[model samples]
Target chain A: MSVLDKIYEKAKANPQKVAFPEAENEKMMQAAYETGKEGYIKPILVGDSTRIKELIAERGYEESVFEIIDIAEESYKNDVVARYVALPHTMLKEKAIGRRMENPLYYAMAMQAVGDADVTFAGIDNTTGDVLLAGQMIIGLKEGISTVSSIGLCDIPGFEGSEGQLLAVGDSAVCTNPTPEQLADIAISACDTVKGLLDWEPRCAMVCYSTLGSGQGELIDKVKEALAIANEKRPDLDIDGEFQLDAAIVPAVAAKKVNRESKVAGKANVLIWPDLNVGNTAVKLIQQFGHADAYGPMLQGFNSIVCDCSRGAPVSEIKGNVVISAVRAMGQK
Target chain B: MERKELEAQIIKMVAQCYNADEAKLSVDSVFGEDISGTSVMMVGLVSEIENELDAMIQLSDAAACKTIGDLVDKVEEEL
Candidate 1:
């Protein structure tokens, strides 16, 4: 089965509560309704209750099918603010708490923080910065993870390297120019995510213009440092790199280009790009030119499950993201 | 660590983050305006400080620190 299908099966076995902070968006509402109706997740929509009811009525979905959290409700607002304040070492001061309490994204994260919700999928009408800030401020990062990065699940059909078609390309949406340390974190997080989502051991390639010592530049230096750092930190991970794209994936090319014997040199399924420019461009190229099915820019490294949707995502994609988030939530539980 | 020692470390780390010499930075140097640090760079700096000091420096708290001195104070507070 496909990743989404496997995720759906797992989600069905363990239904998690997912909050949609952008309930005002029609796409988000539709996806929440569909996913809720299909029993993939228990949808909690954060918005105005009356308006959400109207939208649900218009969409021919029963209002009883999904639970709606009205942000304006005094009790709910107080609950979210209380949760935010309770978070240890929260830098959201008293003055900012009121303003943040007014935001649904914060409310969604607050719900996750306090265990009112299992996961949150947002970013329909918000920028990545806003989503990430809310996540950082409220849900916080997993222990030992200082940076939050993103991973894109690209399923390039007929791709030779991966056992399945799906490959995890990371730091594509967040971390525009990650330092070596941040790049290592991104790779480690992506590997953990693959292990969680795909239930397979991840072989990661730190993708760059150089393969081993074949090329030289500051960029290659950064990749080499990231590879070393990741290897040192996560000795169990099968990761190697400073590889050109061909050397990282194609075994024949890796054999010819890389002098050292390596496990992940050519057969890498997780490609950690050196920078966002390369990672983002490669994912889009795969989506358009390579005709791949791409699903994410999924935010990783948070203590709780939080995924960011592309603002332009359609209803189906939103529903798929909800499933992905549910699957992540299940894994965490 | 003593105040002077901590301040010296903060300045050195900030200068390293900015890819400049420690001589170029001071306790009064503002992080973004004076030292050319981006938000991403600040995150890295926070992680570096946490690792170096073996403390939890909250990102929000780190972001609130405008200058090298402020960062030192934050680190000291965490310590």
Candidate 2:
């Protein structure tokens, strides 16, 4: 089965509660409705409850299919805010928390923070900035993760590599150019993400223009440091690197180029690009020229499963993402 | 360096990091909206300023900087 099929199967087997902060958004609602209908996820639509119910009813769907959190309701809003403030290390006054809770995005994050929801999904109407800020302030980053990043899957049409035709790439959508520390975090997050989403024993390669000592530059140094940091932090994970694309995924090239014992060099199922430039361009090339289907850029490194989809993404892609997020939430919680 | 020159230098550095139009940048440019990728760019700026000025910059302090002015203020305090 395909990665999406496998993930969807997992999602179907254990549908997690995915809270949509932008519940009223057309594409988001459609995707949530479809995912909920398919039993891949239990959608918790957070926004104007009346309108949400109207949308559900208009679509010939049962209102019983969704659990709508009426952001408009005064008592429920106050209760969420109260619960958020009462969480350990909130550091925000009740009034301050209540004030920010006016935004549905913050409200959803607050819900996740206080266990009212499982996963917080957004980024259609809200900028990535708004989502990240809410996630940072409310849900907070995972312990030791300093920034939020993303991971995506690339299923190349004709090219077979590690993990079959499926390979995972990261930091393509959210971070612009990751620093060494952020890159390390991205690598670790990518490993965990694939493990959660694909159930693969992650062999991650930190990619660059060089493979070992074949080339040298400041950029190569950055990739090297990233691998070091990732290895130091999570020694159990098979995260290795400073490999070129060939060395990363091609066994022959890896044998010729990589002079050290590295589990990830040839058998890498996860390729962590050194920066967003490499990641974004690589994914585009694969999609346009290689005729591959790019799966994510799903946001990671948060305390909870947080996601950000492109505003222009279609409802089908959104459903796939929701399914991906649901399966991830299943593994995480 | 005087505060004026320091702010100007930081702004130019930030502009370089962002690859944004230097003419549009200012102390008031919000980190998230104006700069878009604050974590990476701000880390670069902090490291650049630290190396060029021989000043220590904490990444957490840099992360806390919400605006270009806030970053400049942090640099000044460090200096």
The stretch of ten residues in a row with the least summed lDDT in candidate 1 chain A is A89-98
Q: A83-161 in candidate 1: lDDT tens per residue?
A: 7667775545444555565778877888888899999888889887778877876677776565789888888888866
lDDT of 2 at A38: 84
The DockQ value obtained for model 2 is: 0.07
- TM-score, prediction 2: 0.81
Q: Choose the strongest candidate by TM-score.
A: 2
Model 1 achieves a DockQ score of: 0.07
For all candidates, the clash counts are 0, 0
In angstroms, the error of model 1 at A315 is 0.8
DockQ of every candidate: 0.07, 0.07
Candidate 2's displacement at residue B6, Å, is 22
Q: How close is chain B to the truth by TM-score, in each candidate?
A: 0.90, 0.89
Best by lDDT: 2
